[model samples]
Target: MKRDVADFWNLLWEATLGLCALFALLNLFAPPQDLPWVPLDLNRPIGSATGTKVAAFDIARTAAPDQVEATTEACMAALRGADVQVERAEDTDDGGFCQVRGAVRITGGDVTPLSPSVVMTCPLAVRYVLWDRQVLRPAATEVMGSDVARVDNLGTYSCRRVYGSVDASARPSEHARANALDVAGLTLEDGRKVTLLGDWDGAGPAGGDGAVLLKRLRDGACRVFSTVLTPDYNDAHKDHFHLDAASYRLCATGPSRTRRAAADSESG
Candidate 1:
């Protein structure tokens, strides 16, 4: 009888130990998230999100409905002031104002024929020209020793969530609203291609100026666009620079120069 009781207790102890180990492994691999660690009453208001508002496009000031309309007018006026020449595309009868409002066909800028003459929102078209004038040309001249022929872009508008991410709760991407542009890289008048894939670290021979150009251009964009996502942001942005006039200035902090240096050191 005594031996049987001892065996039963030993089995129970081993089972409990196994359960504890399993729980630890699960915690290490997939800790629970999206749960209220602090319990709250369901009936009470949980209020707004909590975090530091660091993005440049974000504003602490809230706008009334009337103010929103007025602000839209002001932004259009600013686009005109920038001399962003655009032709109005025929408005589609789509029941929503989102597709028609501020939509324009960008013909060209100081350069000429924005390649495909993409149809996008006036705000984005205007900002693209601004970036070309203020950031792209100078960055090229300073770093690449040539005038930029044209700013090569992937496109401006898409009607989907970010990268078509499967996250159901993810907010609509700025691309969905025609409020963003993806810059593939710059084109020099001499026909040399400066791509993020090949030249972001610096172009030319090792320690050459082309390599540094990518970093300077990225830093310049931080002051020009609300959100300037670079390769530093993630692998998703490794091929091109994503720029937007969204409500936040999210310029990834590190440059490709530092990235390459770290990689070289690790391998060495």
Candidate 2:
């Protein structure tokens, strides 16, 4: 009986030590089965047109072929749904910018090319603020009382990192990775030029239309993108509206003084 009791205690001790060893091994070498840091927004329903399917993940640094096809389809579909005419679609490796295209006039004018900056892995997270100027036509007509024309691009695919004291080591900008775009200006059919730096704050002849249209565009962008930064947001965004798929929050800023208050809250 004494021997049996001693044997039982020995077995219990071994079991406890085994459990401790197992936990230590798990902590040291095992890959996590669940990720608590990455939060997914499943609110947007997945939809695709006949030719392509919607991407399952955000457009990141590396993109799969199917992801590219899906994102291209989504962008084209959005343009088409807004009645924009796509002149042509071409693939280009302009510093990680994929699938550059020339989308012609849907707002009644000569053909113009629309170059989009789309990233690979994060297909939904694009770097440019693309507008189907066809969609902007009615808004421009209603707001500015004129026939709107072309949407201009400042530049796309710059191989630089984010500005300010963010990070160093020369990481690619959203544009370089085809995740961001910069809009320098726009030209109308009536010979009106609305440049971002020149006309954003009612400074040029196209100021009124530019301001109104930019506001509307920013608002619209918030609905599609997870993050939208406009001229009124901060000095860092004094020129163009920065739109991206951040997956956490949506921000829309306008010319109103209230924009400052909104920015404070957004950053917090």
Candidate 3:
């Protein structure tokens, strides 16, 4: 009986060691992006954890303000490593609702230029470039049969409350801190301009290539931006795609729920 017990224990130990070895082998061979615990690298292809990693930096701004600087530097380093051209913006605090930190103006870097140049927080910039390279450009080529030359924007940073509420007690918007981007239209290589207002659902959902391209961009944006408010959200957003990396966890694809959580984080 003692020999039998000893044999069973030895078998169990061997099985445990084998499992550990298998996992180690898998981790060694897997792509960096495929691993959730792997640190985010802009140079790498977008993986399943890319969105969560990007969102974490914005959340860190509120949850642990002290860590913001370090995260921002790390994020910028990742961008530089990827050969993205960016210039640091001067930090500013309005002594009131608006404050900009770890922000940068994205210039030419294998990315489509933004019309009427705008600055964005580093995290959002990362998402922007990724969306441009991985999602936007490819989608445009596939659907529009043209390369994207420039992206028309409403703006990036504006010190204001949510929905531009005039009341002092109102929750501040992500734009109050250069953390949001309002994309209105896109200019194609073939000189075709597509605007959300005119083309989003312009052809009965999927009739025209223009409408299809808009829908594709919107869907791809949802994958990266923590909060993406589109025309389907409300009349106010009827003209542009509101993409932001705010702490609020919302996609606003069809107005499923109003975001109250952002009010708390936007207080910073």
Candidate 4:
């Protein structure tokens, strides 16, 4: 009995070692986004380690002052390596809870330009570029039968608590620190306009091409952004998609009961 138990333990140990070796070998050829230890590359496709790595950038806002600068530098390095142009904005404190640190205004270079440009945190900017490249562009071509020309956004920085919150003690929104983007519309190369309020439900019950394209964009945002609030989330969000790179993650598409009934009712 003792020999049998010893043999079982030995086999398990050897198997674990073998699996670890295989994993390491595979990771050698995998993209940087797939390897946890590897630094993040904004140009790479989203992979196993992408979420965790991107989340690390949020430390720029949530960590100590020293760490915030370090995290900001690392994030900017990733963006620069991806050939994205950025101009760092001076840090600002509103004399209250809202403060913007290590924020940047994406200037130009290998990125889709935003309409009425606004400044944003490094993490948010990185995720926006990724979303534009990997999600919005592809979905537009595949579903809308056109390429995206410009992304129209409502705004970025607002020194206020969460919208509709009556409590003065309510947590400050990501916008308060320029860590969020309120995506309002997309103008396609073919000159068609798609807006969250108009095309969220699409043209039919099963949804038309516009609805499919919008949903795809939403789903793609969820993969890269830590927080994604769609119109289905509530009336307050009925006109735009709220995407953010906060420390916490939440994909608030809608209520559970409604979701259970029609799973395809909303965005990411």
lDDT of 2 by residue, 139-239 (tens): 56666666645556554444556562235555445454444445555566677766666767776777576777766666656555556676666677767
User: Model 3 residue 118 lDDT?
Assistant: 87
Using Cα atoms with residue i matched to residue i, what is each candidate's TM-score against the true structure?
Answer: 0.61, 0.51, 0.81, 0.82
The true-versus-predicted C-alpha distance at residue 49 of model 1, in Å, is 27
Better of 2 and 4 by lDDT: 4
Model 1 stretches with alpha carbons more than 4 Å out: 1-83, 90-100, 109-113, 203-207, 255-268
Task: Judging by TM-score against the true structure, name the best candidate.
Answer: 4
Over all chains combined, what TM-score does candidate 3 have?
0.81
Cα distance off (Å), candidate 4, residue 30: 4.3
lDDT of 4 by residue, 1-268 (tens): 9999999999999999999998888777777778888877776788889888877777543568888778788888888888998877777788887899878888888888898888999888989989988898888888878888899999899888998466888999989889999998788888888888888877533248877887888889999898899888877788889999887889875553356457665542
Model 3, residue pairs in steric clash? none
lDDT of 2: 0.49
- Please give the range of 10 consecutive residues that has the lowest summed lDDT in model 2: 43-52
**What is the RMSD of candidate 3?**
7.2
Best by lDDT: 4
* TM-score (C-alpha, index-matched) for candidate 1: 0.61
| Clash count per candidate | 10, 14, 0, 0
